[model samples]
Target: EPEVTQTPSHQVTQMGQEVILRCVPISNHLYFYWYRQILGQKVEFLVSFYNNEISEKSEIFDDQFSVERPDGSNFTLKIRSTKLEDSAMYFCANRLRLATDTQYFGPGTRLTVL
Candidate 1:
């Protein structure tokens, strides 16, 4: 299993500011990547990146966020309009091979919106 590393391990911004968080996954694991945000006691799915397929998003995929894979191994999650409530530990994670496999997570990026 390969590990995913998220850069800038932590970020802070004023409410309404824009922030971009990055994820770097191993090449072979490029089949896809998904993101979820963990805040307090809840884990909510955010988005999924498919190499050549239509991306999937959750209800929380509201207008304030955007995602892009700048290259083969890196994925970026952008918060176009950060709110105080958007502050949380955002994780880039997904199951590698099968459903039975435990989901792997990147070093979560802590986003703090002031």
Candidate 2:
């Protein structure tokens, strides 16, 4: 079966640099989302995109963050300016629909900022 794949399972970056986390969602899904977990915190939704525009975004998705479908299969999240608090496990997920649908998450990209 197809699955979501994330790159650089762990990443360490400076407090003012940029980082791009990559993901490949399930091949046949139409909806995509990004969520983050700060250590022991709950998974917080960042944004959800479909049909090439943002469907929903949480307060946590500030100007510093952006996402894109660079190609047919690759989805990427870019943080323009990182902060120490930005460190977390970024998970990429996708599902066919929202009503009664379950998201399939990637292994997660752990970002560490110092």
lDDT of each: 0.76, 0.93
RMSD in Å for all candidates: 2.2, 1.1
Task: Name the lDDT of candidate 2.
Answer: 0.93
Residue 29 CA displacement from its true place in model 1, Å: 1.1
In model 1, where do residues sit more than 4 Å from their true spots? 52-54, 95-102
**Candidate 2, 40-83: lDDT as tens digits:** 99999999989778899999999999999988678889999999
TM-score of each: 0.84, 0.95
- Tens digits of lDDT, candidate 1, 1-114: 568889889898999889999888765664455555656566777877676453688888888888877765687888998988888888887556554756678888998889
* Top-lDDT structure, candidate number: 2
Give candidate 1's error at residue 99 in angstroms: 5.9
